[model samples]
Target chain A: MDILVFALCLAIGIAAGYRNWLPPYLTSRSSWGLTAAVYLLLFLIGCELGSYRSVLEQMSGLGVQAAALCLGGLLGSALLCRIVGGGGGV
Target chain B: MFDPKPILVLLAGVILGAMGHLPEGFDDLIGPLLRGALILLFLAIGFDMGKEPRLWETLRSLSGRALMMPVAALLGSVAGGILTGITVGLPVGLAASASAGCGYYSITMILLKEAAGIEAATIGFVANLAREVLTILAMPLFVRYFGKAGALGAAGATAMDTALPFIIRSAGKEVAVHAFVSGVILSLIIPLSVPLIYRLLS
Candidate 1:
């Protein structure tokens, strides 16, 4: 559902841009706008994390398991990149 | 390409939030505000992509390598998750399901709840949440050392949203589109994979 909404917004934005529906000024300053939006997005993510106090407690209690899984996934990804990443690094 | 500025903002937010300083009614605002900001961000990304005259040409050239990255990531995540689960004494099947969430907490948690029950769902939540936090903190370094694919792999399903900006900043605009495509594919696959894995395990 979230992905669908985001995709819909992206498609609408592209169409709007292509057809000149959005004002030129807004389009011109979009890079800055995008950056600001990113800031807000991360802030909200942090807030969500903070609100979930039980999650934090769980994290602390199960720190080793969580860290192990996270690191293992990342390591697996890196290893896979070595095997399947045909093109050189960007 | 990586900037310290945005990360500082993220850290500040975390600090303030941890300190219990979010304003009254702020909790209510988070969901809508996040969705709204996401729309605006995607709109900006789409507009930017549309304006690039050579975008199609680049995507064509990059598609093969780009397409392979996410498949690799998914495989790696499952392997890693199962490995962790075994080390931690969790059933391998349950661990694989949790890892299948691939850093997409909400979708993974809900799916695990329905398919594997609340315990698996909780593990999924923690594991996927850990992935997101790790991606946010380490993406630039991943790009710097391991290249664009590593960053995308770490981002999992979040390459489309919370991690998109950092991916762009770290890997550049060229990789950003690939990240979006990879993220989309992973997001689509996750909904099915979580349940399928659970069922298979059961």
Candidate 2:
């Protein structure tokens, strides 16, 4: 269901863009709609996290473990991809 | 591209919520409002990708090596989690599944809730959100040192939407396409793989 809803929105938008369905004013980046949408999502995500009081409380106790997991995963990804990917840089 | 403005806005929202400033019954509204906003964001991102003048030309040029990006990302995350989980004395399954969320917090939490319980779900939520924030903040360094796949792999599902600005800024528009592709692939697969691995390991 999560994938379905996400893909449906993306497909609709792609079709609209491909077919020039949205008005130029909206489709153009000048409207800053995209920026607004992104910022809104980020803000909402923060709100969602903050609303979960237990999660917030647990953060203090479990944060070190979480950070360790994050770093390990990140480093493993970088190392493996670096070895195999030839460091395809910008 | 490394805009601190969005991060600041996020922190402001967090402070407001933490302070209970959102008024009574706002909690119920947050989920729906966030969904609406996310839909809009996804649409905008898709439209931008679709309207790129060289979209097809770029897609056509994708190499076999580029296709391997998500694989490396998936395995690397699992390997890292297993090792870290052992070092930390946590369940390997628990840590691996959480890290495999690939920064997609909402879905990862849901998956953990079903597969494990609320406690495990909470851990998954935090771990994955950290991955997202870290990717947003440090994508440039990941790209500079570890290469495009390093950043994209670390970004996981966010390589498409949440992490795109950083990836594009650090790696360029061409590699951003690869980021989008790998992100889409990981997004699709993570939902499936996370659960299976958890069930197997547990």
Candidate 3:
């Protein structure tokens, strides 16, 4: 369901973009628009995270696990990218 | 380009939420509002992608290989989390779930809370939150050391939003689009993988 929403939304944007459907002013402001949308999304996510009292309550105790997992996730991906040579050069 | 505004705003939201003073129905409004924001973000992404002349050409040439980055992200995080769990004497299942959060703190924590318990959920929440912060902080370093794709891997599902500013600045617009694709794939995988991993571990 979430995947469908993501794909559908992307498709709509692509189609609109391909046809030049949006107003010139809006298209010109796309960068800021995108940035604003992302900020709104992150803020909402923060709100949701804060609403979870249990998670908040126990946050301090989980520090080690949090550090370990973050390091692990980053390190693992770094290692894999190194081996796979995933750089396509944008 | 490497603006501090997004992270600051996110922190402000968390503080406001912690205060627990949102008016009635504001909580209810969050669901639809978040979805709307996400759609708008994706639309902008797609539009930028569509405007690119090389979009289709790049996709066609790299169709199969392009997928490896996301796959590597999934595999690396899972393995790394499990190893961390064993080393730290934490339960393997809980560690995996926390790792699976993949920088998506809210959803992952909620799901783990429902499926596992408070401890697991807390770990998921903090770990994923740390992942996002670390990604933002370490992005330039990742780009320098591991290149664009590696930075996206560290970003996990956040390539679409929270980590995007750094991604765009460091890697350029084209890599930002690829990061979005990678992010979307990982986002889709997280929901399924969390439960599957939970069930398997139990």
Query: Tell me, what's the RMSD of every candidate?
Result: 7.5, 5.7, 6.3
Off by over 4 Å in 1: A1-63, B1-62
Best by lDDT: 2
The two-chain DockQ for each candidate, comma-separated, is: 0.37, 0.42, 0.39
Indicate the docking level reached by candidate 3.
Answer: acceptable
Tens-digit lDDT track of model 2 for B7-126: 577678778878878778876786677667656766776677567657656556778777788778878987897788678766888888988887777656655655675567667767
> How displaced is residue A40 in candidate 1, in Å?
23
lDDT of 1 at B180: 79
Better of 1 and 3 by TM-score: 3
Q: Residue B19 lDDT in model 1?
A: 87
Tens digits of lDDT, candidate 3, A1-90 = 244565677778778877888999988888688767767766776676676787677666577777887788777766675556556552
Is 2 or 3 the stronger prediction by lDDT?
2
Compared with the true structure, what per-residue lDDT tens digits does model 1 show for residues B1-202? 2245654665576578778898999877866676566567667766766665465465566657677877888888889888877898777777787787788776565556445544565567668777887888887788776777777777888888888998888788877777877787686567567767766765
TM agreement with the true structure for every prediction: 0.59, 0.65, 0.62
Give the per-residue Cα lDDT of candidate 3 at A35: 68
Query: lDDT per residue, candidate 1, A1-90, as tens digits?
Result: 334565676677767766777788887887788668767776666555556666557665455666677777776765676467633452
lDDT of 2 by residue, A1-90 (tens): 254565677778778877888878777772387778756766665666667687678776577777777878777777777776777642
Better lDDT candidate (1, 3): 3
